[model samples]
Target: GGSIKHDISVPVSRMADFIAQASEAVTARLPGIRPVPFGHIGDGNIHFNLSQPVGMDKSEFLALWGEMNAIVHGIVRGMGGSISAEHGVGQLKRDEIAATKSPVEMAMMRALKQALDPKGILNPGKVV
Candidate 1:
């Protein structure tokens, strides 16, 4: 079974809340879904992962990747967390970051990207 991966960082103060609320939120959607959340508690960077329910088909559980990401990421956003903690915005998260950053922030990023890679040749779609 493929596990959906989310590397997110919330404030140290909100780490506990993020875990509790996110666990509750996802479980509410799919009963018996096991949350295997763990990581650096001091830094507030958590590899908030969910393992499939017992006896459920692996493909079926894998099919919920997008929904599970939205549910988990939504909670991360609500808590002012970075969707990517240790990792940068690569192919997997380029599109999703727009929702996380403000329009002005995004625009500034674009401007910087343009200044740095005027020809649009560096890691083409790996970031904003």
Candidate 2:
């Protein structure tokens, strides 16, 4: 239950390539590890989960989040993928998504949010 999850997506054409390249990079940097790469390939979103190398400390293993995220997401974005796929934005990726999405798209999303929640009290600052 303590595992971190990143719901990322890539273009259909680049799905296989992204998985191969990303898995290769992560393993190269962190040896003796097995990446549990599994997700929706049709939509190009792979839940690239990594378990600690045998006998490795969990805390020490998790301390590599920043570096691992940068490496994985960098490849995903380089291939035109959204680092946050089906999983709606939370505190972790709110600013990151906002910075990348276009103004028009963001405006439309906000309009929809306001329409459904006119009082701005329903889950405010959660999705929009």
Please give the range of 10 consecutive residues that has the lowest summed lDDT in model 1. 119-128
lDDT per residue as tens, model 2, 1-128: 12445678988898889879988998999896667778887878788777777877888888887788788888877988887877766667777777667888778877887899889898778655
Global lDDT of model 1: 0.88
RMSD of each: 2.2, 2.2
Model 1 alpha-carbon drift over 4 Å, by segment: 107-124
Q: What lDDT does model 2 reach? A: 0.78
Clashing pairs in 2: none
Q: CA lDDT of 79 in candidate 2? A: 86
Q: List lDDT for all candidates, in order.
A: 0.88, 0.78
lDDT of 2 at 59: 83
Model 2 has how many clashing residue pairs? 0
Q: Give the TM-score of candidate 2.
A: 0.83
